[model samples]
Target: MSATIVRRSAIMTAAVAASALFLASCSSGGSSDPSDSATGSDSASAPTGVTLVMWHQSADADPQLNLYKAYEAASGNTIELVDLPADTYTTAVQTKWATGDRPDILEYVPTPQDMRQLNMSENMLDLSDLAFVGNRVNDAGELDGAVYGAVLGPLSSFGMFYNKDVLDAAGVDVPTSYGDLMTSCDAVTASGADMVNIGGGSEFPVNMFAGFAYMADYNEGDQWGQGVADGSIKVNDPEGPIVASLTTMKDLVDAGCVNSDAATATFQDSIAAVYDGSSALTILPSDFISLFYEAGGGDTATVDETIGFGPISAEKGIGSYSASPIGSYFVPSTGDATKEAAAKDFIDWITTEGYQDYVDEAQAVPTLTNATTPDLGGLYASLADVLMDPSTTPAFNQSVPGFGSFGQVSVSVLVGQASPQEAADTWQAYVDQAIEAQQ
Candidate 1:
């Protein structure tokens, strides 16, 4: 077998960690009174033979998809899976809701705007008290003290990923502070290689800003979205912490430490650059490490041994890193009791014992500490440690509502289309629009 196929097969086997056992029922079929109003027990009153229309974007090979089929077969309930296109899925879902043809369950990125767009607070079944909520590592979709969403994949963090062999060859010690990082970048470049493989073609520049801002938040001990909530600060202050954070990325650009083809390189391309030893470092979320391994044709051991993960920092030197939610599933309160109960049952089942299998199959970080970790090894394992830290805070984009504009504005600054101040002003407008949308 080809090495790539071997690795792909390994990934698939890992994701299918264990065969899933169909739960007792997808419906609340017991004789319990139907209108009990208790969250967990509602399943007992769900009717059998009810078809749940699940609208989602999970891949055909996703382990959860198989589990969906298992639940259907075991409980005699039906799951009408409507797979949607990724780029237009959210808009399509909104259309369905507007036209009164929404699905019972929804799959989305779980961003604040996405949640609000679905009328989450008003329409989703609250999973706050589910057994799995207690095992969660972070508070993501919790709003007004209610858990409205469940993750379909593992939680992950964004930070700096470095190639130890490359850095060592350049005699650059792992950077401890933002200034040290700049110095290291210069040294790595001077060694005749790219210092950081920042793929600027898409929203990576936004990720760059976010990485620095996350470090700043850790250094200053201020939560990223707290200012918006308490009215103490605005995200768009030209001189604010967020915009100020971009100065580091801009300096890197000026210093020629960023890959010259960054403007056109995709994130996977950058990962490949690092894997090929053409670059010493890159900024990305921990989840993308799988691609780094894949680019090496499944040479998991060499990839893990050569690369290292560390938190990017300001003066505080690794005060914290940011945790972002991934694979969020929501049970929209479709106002149909049977469907709602079935949705709850399905969500609840996935998050239970079957969750580990899902995590294994997906090769994602388990939100529950008790779940087994996939054998990703090396930098991924190291980054996973940081993600498990109690001091970890939510990423700025995840914490702040309507924060997609931050990425767009950051892109303009990276490309020299806007000054930092101009970008901040533009970001402020987005923030204002976001707030207005919430209202």
Candidate 2:
């Protein structure tokens, strides 16, 4: 999930036209920079007054909220913040759109399905004019050649989070390959502990593994993805790489490499195992480094030294990783032009140097080129090298569709309700169906 820029070629002509229409309908008409003196000045000094409404679903909202307030104060505009609960944000937004009462600006992750559903090319603001969203060498949120949203910052790479104390006590080297991991599982379990704590109740992790497998076995620029997109690849295609990946995951469970209670555990519970020293590893994002340190009741310094990270190792060749933008702000097709302008201003300000500085200070990565590194107690710095080269190790979870189903598959495989082959088959089936629906 490391945020590396990716270059995609132009889409078909039909896609381009559709995108153009979508952009036109959603156009809010304003400069991409919110902090421009002309846009931020008081009404007495500026051309007109504007009001904006924004919706966001991140767990950490205070920093953004305060930042928004400052933007409003400085720009002399009225800005309203709508904080949606994480679980319901998707449904809520859909409902708003269905009711024809969309927010002026909203945050969304632009998955392929999302692109198809929103027809975003014709229904969202064209952010290509913005420096942060447009200037990146690889623009991730673009769909069908029309950029919909701006990424918040660099992508966070996902990998196995291990407890050094547990691994050391078990005499297992940090695993560098799938074979090594399988061998380490035996020693970990012989120590009377679970090798990995998995949250089977959730679906995201299982889907992540499926995606990772696809990336690990194939080159990033290959036709596997296009095949999936165009209905040429079957989820249960007998000869597909998905089956092998699922088999590996199944092998892990069959060999007692993961917690037996994984099927019923919630995400928090699984993560708690690592913090409490009951398990050796948990697949998660780099941001979790901060959370783990805080949860262990240790200061940043202690956590930085104690935690270690590396890419997911492969048996032979390198592995590719997947990542998505932190959700982005999108202006709707039906908002008032003035409000839309205001909304765009807010987006511009948030991605600017002033806001990125705040993000850096908060220890979060910034998307802008001039972004300053946050003082994250050296946790991020420790893993910086690994994060940058994730694709060279194990595949990331982003390359797959239906990423939400990861946990369910993990649970099924762990509990023996499904064999590795069966799980892989089911996952591929689901992904194939999803891809078809989008098409």
Candidate 3:
């Protein structure tokens, strides 16, 4: 579902490319100028058939699309949805922004890393003081204590999802840290299975390799970005999370603690490796439960029975909430006073008055205090447990601007091409570069 989770563009060229794509897409959808700058009130006017341009990817669920229709019917406001192509959505958005074009409302990944690209602090309407803020299950879109994105449904957190039966058979308690994980490799290998399956080939989950360690910090890494930004923290610190985590990865490789085909393994392979009992565990997001569903013939019963979820950390069981903001919506600082107010009203109404209906429409596990969690399954329950954990905090990628690149070199740790220190050094270079660019 993710891919733009990072990608930079050739500013001028992408802007040119975006012009044709934007026009073509807008012609078929509803056309609106994103550069509207008639600033006025921050409050919504009574419904008068105002059309709000909403930019979303094709992956926007039918429930959400239908919800928009329901919203229009109730409020008499027209939501002109623009379905941008998922692959180029971020770059296209960036390009549109480069040319001073923006949507009234936009759906995005809602990560500090991603938000940094959008300059959310300067560009997005703050949702911190909204009435429903207290009801939110997690702070998915908060940066520097300011909330900017509202995640209405769906949740994800990353960790080492293990096969309970396999780990139990291996006589391994859920290891508290990567070092603790290594102490059980002998027991795990003796049980005739690999220790963990790093899905290196997909390259998507690689970030979690080192991120788990950073996220498990004392403050759950909420201040990680601030540290890096203010030059108080260094990515390449020899004793830091990056080197320590990556070194453990290399040690796992040497200790025969990973799958034989770990280098080429995909997410599917990692799922099967653990679920089919070929490996004890895999490092992935809570959504691995969804993939395991496919492996088990779409059976939630099988998924719940065989799989187990636990938070991963460097030296403790502490974890971070890493949910993808699927139903999250961001209102741009579009400067059209009327549209801005309507956008705020939409957020307020959906999260308050229309919330129950919204939850029912998505069949989502309740992430609000007012709603009750439905009977999705044991797997869904586990996913929600980690997502709503009181101790967990937003991940580094969720707090640090441009922090996505910090973990970009983690796959090299998996393939043994870079030593832990080397990986950390590379990350430090990226951090320095990002800080310079931001400054």
RMSD of 2: 8.7
- List TM-scores for all candidates, in order: 0.77, 0.78, 0.73
- Expressed as tens digits, the lDDT of each residue in 3-120 for candidate 2 is 2223322111222332344355346451133344234433333223567767666443344556666666667767676776543455566777677667777776554455455668
What is the lDDT of every predicted structure here? 0.63, 0.57, 0.68
Error of 2 at 1 (Å): 22
Model 2 misplacement above 4 A = 1-53, 61-66, 69-73, 76-101, 217-219, 313-327, 362-366, 372-377, 390-411
What lDDT would candidate 1 get against the real structure?
Answer: 0.63
Stronger candidate by TM-score (1 vs 2): 2
What would you estimate as the lDDT of candidate 3?
A: 0.68
Q: What clash count goes with each model?
A: 7, 21, 0
Candidate 3 residue-wise lDDT, 160-214, digit = tens:
7788888899998876578777888999899998888877766665666667533
Please report the candidate that would top TM-score against the real structure.
2
Q: Residue-wise lDDT of candidate 1 within 50-142, one digit each (tens)?
A: 799888753333455765765665456788988875324556677878887778877765645466666777788899867778766545566
Which has the higher TM-score value, candidate number 1 or candidate number 3? 1
